[model samples]
Target: MTATPRAVDAKEILLTWLTDQVSVPVVSTRPDNKDAPATFVRLLLTGGTGRHDRALHTTQLTIDSYAPTTAAAVELALAVDAAVHGAVAGLSPVVRVSGTSPSESPDPDTTSARATATYQITTRLLT
Candidate 1:
């Protein structure tokens, strides 16, 4: 619904933002069956919907951070949350971000920790 035929890929935008802000590598999906980096982030598009009449769309995103230690994971997660919670408006293609919730967990690797931060973004198509 943008003025042009192209629609913004919110997930990719967030991934780039995280990569730039966090100074960590971000991937859209975990590799087929390989161990992820000891300190990295993964971006997932959990949900999305659009309203044709208003030319508006909402995307739900989850950013997962992994670190070698719980403390590091928490710090990284906090950084990710801060970077995303109010960042959409500054990015290209224009979007508003909200509804942030961050969680931390011990990774199955036992030696690593993981943190997940979720956010909802609403984007309006240019007329």
Candidate 2:
């Protein structure tokens, strides 16, 4: 079995996958100096579960897609959903991506919108 990948590893896997499949920036945090792009994605590790004696884990994460319009945000989110909804080959510890749940809202005080896609990834725990 593969060793469990760290949270950063999981994020990198997701970032690479998203950047390869979609033509947009996939970031871990909002950019500090530059103006936010018209469309971008942020990957966040929300939670996880593992057992003491077992080498298996389930990780949860959210991919937040931001865009200038609700329709655009939804479209970007759907694309991410399609990318993550099933097994992805690159994640080291992640054996499979089980599913995704979606939510959407307007970015604070702006015309921009955000679509958050939550994912559940099954992995082999490493120790």
Q: Which structure among the candidates has the greatest TM-score? A: 1
- TM-score, every prediction: 0.79, 0.77
Q: Write the per-residue lDDT of candidate 2 for residues 6-111, one digit (tens) a residue.
A: 3335666677878888889999986545577878888988876644236566777788888877888989998888877533565466677855555786667556
In model 1, which regions exceed 4 Å deviation? 1-6, 31-36, 109-111
**C-alpha lDDT values of all predictions:** 0.73, 0.73
Steric clash count of candidate 1: 0
RMSD of each: 3.2, 3.7
Per-residue lDDT over 3-121 for candidate 1, one digit per residue giving the tens place of the 0 to 100 score: 55335677877787777888777888754345657788888889866544466667788878888777788788888888886576567664667755667766564466888877777
